[model samples]
Structure formats: structure tokens, C-alpha cells
Target: MGRYVRADGLDIWTEQVGTGPDVLLVGGLGDTVESWHFQLDGLADRYRLTAFDNRGAGRTAMPEDPVSIETMADDAAALLRALDIPSAHVAGFSGGSIISQELALRHPRLVRSLVLQSTWPVPDAYLRRWGLFIRWLAETAPAERTFLEGFYLDIYTPRAHNDGTVDRFIEDVLAFPHKQTTENLNRFLDAVLDHDTTNRLPDIDVPTLVLAGGRDSTSRPELGRAVADAIPGARFAVMEEEAHQPFQEIPDEWNARVDAFWRATQTRTT
Candidate 1:
């Protein structure tokens, strides 16, 4: 059910399921197609959904060449073209949302609609410093779980940690075989560090929905508001109960929200 499609000079590992209007789901930093298991399972019956690994993550082997958000956007465009999809609804999480912005700007024809979750228009001073620190931590941390502990603390709410969600995820990461190398993680972070679409967001004329986690410190709600305000006619909302990952933590709620937006876009466009 999973396979590789050659795109942007490398074999991009991708998974496609169900049928109907196309939906491309892009994951956050270091995420693979597997990161979207909930969506692939929940929304596939109604929409054709495809998820893939970014250039420097997952089964898509990190290339020796430099990586950037712009190039990764190009990769997503190539993946759609290679799959014979003229255009589709595109949804992205965190870093993936940054790439989605670039994809919509660089290849506007390839994006029918955008669902940007936990996104920001650009990294502010605090966020830039945070990115640097995270990259440094990834490179110097003693153990994988050590870094993940810190990461989990920053991303998930206290409720998740207390409810055993964080513990279960740590175990899942530890048991996963396709561990992302620190080198690849740093590269991906570099791409995120360089992402800035503040000036260009207005150019994106497609139907766009920007969702923010009210408790997210990394990509704060203010940042999401700025992005929404910059983009012409884009709608913005907040999932107050979620932190960085509502789709994983509350799949049903997340799926219903995005599905409503996607179908509404289809209706208006058709």
C-alpha cells in the first residue's frame, strides 16, 4: 500500500489510499508518511489522500546537496505532477505548513486549497533562537530519548504528559526502526529556520484555512493570526485544547474541521 515515486531527482516514499478529490497531507519536521496514519484512515473513505516524506526525512534518503524550504516545496509539486494530479487540497503541519506556503506561492496551480495547522508567517526573534537551540540539542544530546523528553515537554500540554500520552509516544519512537539521523534532523531544522513567507502570503489566492494551537509556544497563536491577516481572505481558528499536534491527539475533531473546510471549498469552486 506504500511505494516510492521518483520526484525532484530522488525517490520520494509516498502512500495513497481511497478515491475522490485529491488531498495531499505533508508532515512536520522529521515526519514520514506514517505520521499521517490517522488521516489516511479517517478521511480516505471520502477523499483520495496522499502523504509523503520530505526531502531530508523518513525513507526518502537525505541527499548530499543542501536542503531548503523552497526546494522541498518544489518536491511536493513534482510529486503531484508525477502522480498525475493536476491540483488538490493541501494540508500541512508545523514545518510542513511553511513548505505548503511556499508550494502555494511557487506552484500555485498545484494547490487547490490550503489547511495550515500550527503555522507561522515567519520566525520571530524568540522562534529563531528556539530553532537554533533545538538544532544544537539534536546534534549534542547524549541519547535520542533525552532529546525527545525535552521535545515532548515543549510540544505537548501538561495534560498529555499526565495522561500517559507522552510516555506512549516516547516508547513508540524508541521502538520505531527508521530513526532519523541527527544529521538529517539538523538539515530539516535548517530548512525551517530559513522559512519566511510574510511578504508573499497575500499572493496565495487559493482557499486557505489557518489553524493554530492556542497553547503552542513554538508557533504562537499571534503568529498564526499574522499569517491569516496577511493572506487575502484566509480564515483562521484556534484549537484551544491542543498544543502542537491536534491531528494526532484529537484526530476526530481535527479531521472533521479540515473535512468541512475542504468540502466547502469544493462547493464554492465547483
Candidate 2:
């Protein structure tokens, strides 16, 4: 069931379902618990899944302070503490993946395992340029739908656009009642662009997996490879034909891959 829970001074919208080892899902920029609906449904039989809206998005109101990836990571830690989950497999996508890194670093004991999806240690020149365009569009787009279309181009593959999947997402963004404020959206992107954890990956000692969309332009394969290389034992894999949001595009396949990894971690611990 969905409800609000106080964590890190924010009344976060959180949900938990199923029964078993805990698995916490973290969404990227502009996402909510609804972002993990497929995982909640597909993997719930074997895992107790939890998800929440990050501060500045969805039902969680933006804090008066500027959006920072470290604070967002702290929020994740606080939510898990609030929920009484000592530790759980943590999976984060895109911006969420960045936040997950901080969570694992700042509160290592709170994360049983780490799954970084469409992640990067730091943006290379290519992503830096793209980030600039994203910020400009977010600040200047004529309409919400227009901004969403521009923002999604690099996030999903051409196939999704051709098949109407992206258009549907555009509609959903337009209709969402709790929209992210323009100020927060830009600040959120700042946190993403300014983030640098290339030096800290080796500090994370937990079981780690880094997933990349082979066709993704936002956080490309090379960036993901660099992240995996930095983390001592982190494994890296790519969905060759998939783009950034494969969890949304091909959720069953994504779920299966992550499930297997999570199980492997349990076996090693046992």
C-alpha cells in the first residue's frame, strides 16, 4: 500500500509489497514509486520491494535547500531506516543510480547489494555537452510536453519513439498532478552534472552490478564501463539493443537479470 512516511525531514511517498528479502527501488529524475510498478509486480513474489519518490519530485516536496545528490542519497538511507529495513538490495536507475552510489558510500551498512542501471561515474565530454542542452531545454521549453519530448530523446531508443511508447510517457508526464517545479528540475540536473564519484567506487565493498543500455546516449556504455572498472568487484553488462529505460521498455527481461544477480549475492553471503 502507498502512504507518506517522514524521512530526512521530507514526507516521502513510499510503498512496500510482497514478502521475503528486502529490495529497495530508486527512481531517476522526475520519477515516483509508480516508476517501479513493473518491478513491484514482477518480482514481489520472491522479494519485499520498497520504492519512494525522491525529494523534489512526485509527492515529496522540494526542500528549501538546493537539490544535492548526497542529500538525496541520505534520504534513501533515512527511508530505509524509517521502514525498519536494516539493509536491502538497492537498485537505482540513471540519476537514481548516482544517488545509490552515495547511499552505499555514506551508509554502507544500509545497502545489502548495489545495482547501478544506466549509470556513470562521471560524465565524459559527450554527456557534459548533453547535460548542458538538457538544462537549457528544461529552463526554456515552451510547454511541459515539449520539454518531456526533448528530454526523452536520449533516454529511450528510436524504436520506443517509433512505437508510441515515448509519446505515452509524454502524456503521463503532462497529466501528473504533482509536477516537479522548474527550479528544482534545473537544480536536480545540476546535482547530476556536478556529481563525481570516480574516485570513491573502490570504497564500496558490497556486491555490485552495473548495467548499461548499449544504445543509450545519455549514460553510454563507455561511461558505465568506467564505473564498473572503478568499483573493485563490480560486474558490468550491457543490453546491446536497449536504451536507457529498459526497465520500463523490457521490464521482464530487466527484472530477471537483476533477480538473478540479487540471488547470487544471497548465496555468496550464505
Candidate 3:
């Protein structure tokens, strides 16, 4: 069932699946809980997976003012509190990873383990340019096909495009109901561009696993390594055949890696 959790004056759309140790799934820019559909069944048997749509995305209400990563982090923490969850293993993708970092930093007690996938600690010139390009596309050609095609070009590898995987992905994206508005897209882009957590990463004390896609030009493997290196004892792994969205591209492999890391963390804590 779908429910709304009030956080930071916004009604955030949240969904919970399975019943076990809590795992919070935070999606990327313009992504909703639906984006984690591939992971729902994969991790459900071992975890009580909770996912929510960030402000300005999905069924969640847009903020009256521009929102920052810190604000979104607080929103995530607030959602957990509202649900009476004391702590959870947090996994975040792309922009969501930045929010996850802030969550761990600001609300340490709320995060038990961290998974940062296709993430960057700070925005470089290349990333800034790409963010601007996405904003331009959102403003000029916000059609489903245009956006999906652009995303396919950026997030998937040539192997995926050659094997009709991109075609299938486009169809899936078109079927999704909650599409971000141009204004909200721009706002999200702005927030992502402003995100800088390089200096704060060392403060994240939770067990962390940084997953990088070798072919990810969006946030490159090097960036993921940097994030892992900054965090005291964070472990880093690269999915050589995947691109930005490894979880979607290689669900079985992705789920296995995450499950192994979560289990290891649990063992260590116990």
C-alpha cells in the first residue's frame, strides 16, 4: 500500500515492502519509488525495503522554495522517524547518494550501513556541464521520448544499446506515471549542482559500500573511489560491464553485492 509521510512540511509518498531489517532506498534525480521496482523482489526476502519519492518528484509535493541536499537528507530522516524506524541500511543512487551522505552525517543514529552507487562527492566542471545540459533538455524538449533517449545515451553502455535493452528501458520509462515537471527538474538540477560533501565524508562512521560502474561517464568510477577513500573504512567495488544505473542494468549482481555487504555489516556490528 502507498502512504504519505509528512516531512519538512511536505507530504512525501512512501512505500514499504517485505519484513526484515529495514533498508531505505533513495532514488536519483527525477526518480520515484517506482525506479527501484527491480530491487523490490530482489531484496525483499532479506529486508523490509522502504522507498520514498523526494520532494518535487512522484506523488510528493514540490517545495515552495528551492530545496538543498541537506533538506532532503532531513526529509529522509524525518520519514524514518515518522515510521518509527530507529535505524536502517541506506542505499542511494546518483543525486540520492549525496542526500544519503548528508543523512549519515546529520543523523548518524538513523543509518546503520550505507550504499553509495554511481555517486560523486562533489560536482566537477564536467558534471556541472552535464547537469546544465539536462536542464536545457528539460526546458526545451521535455517529451518522454526525448528525455528517455537522452538518458539511454548517458546511463547505458553500448552493449545495452546494441541488444535492445535501451528500447525496453524507454518503454518502461514511458509507462511511468509520475514525470517531473520542467520547473521541478531545473530545481533538482540546481540542488545537485550545489551538493558538495567531500569534506564531510570522513565524518560518516557507518559501514559503507561504494558501488561504481566502470562505464559510467556520468559520475565515473574514479569519483566513486574518491568517495570510498574519503570515508574511513568504506569498501569500493566496480561493476565493470555496467553503466550509471547498475542496479537496473544488472539487478542480480547488484543485489548480491548489496546483500553481502549488508550481511557483513550486521555480523560486524553484532
lDDT of 3 by residue, 156-230 (tens): 898888999889978977887787887887887799899899998999999999999989988999999999999
TM-score of each: 0.98, 0.97, 0.97
Between candidates 1 and 3, the lDDT winner: 1
Best by lDDT: 2
lDDT of 3: 0.90
| lDDT (0 to 1) per candidate | 0.91, 0.92, 0.90
Expressed as tens digits, the lDDT of each residue in 1-270 for candidate 2 is 889999867899999999999999999888899889899999999999999998888888888887789999999999999999999999999999999999999999999999999999988888889988988898899998888888888999999999999998788777889888877777888899899998988999999999999999889989999989999899999999999999999999999999999999999998
Q: Which stretches of candidate 1 lie over 4 Å from their true place?
A: none
Model 2 vs. true fold: TM: 0.97
Ranking, TM-score, top scorer first:
1, 2, 3
Better of 1 and 2 by lDDT: 2
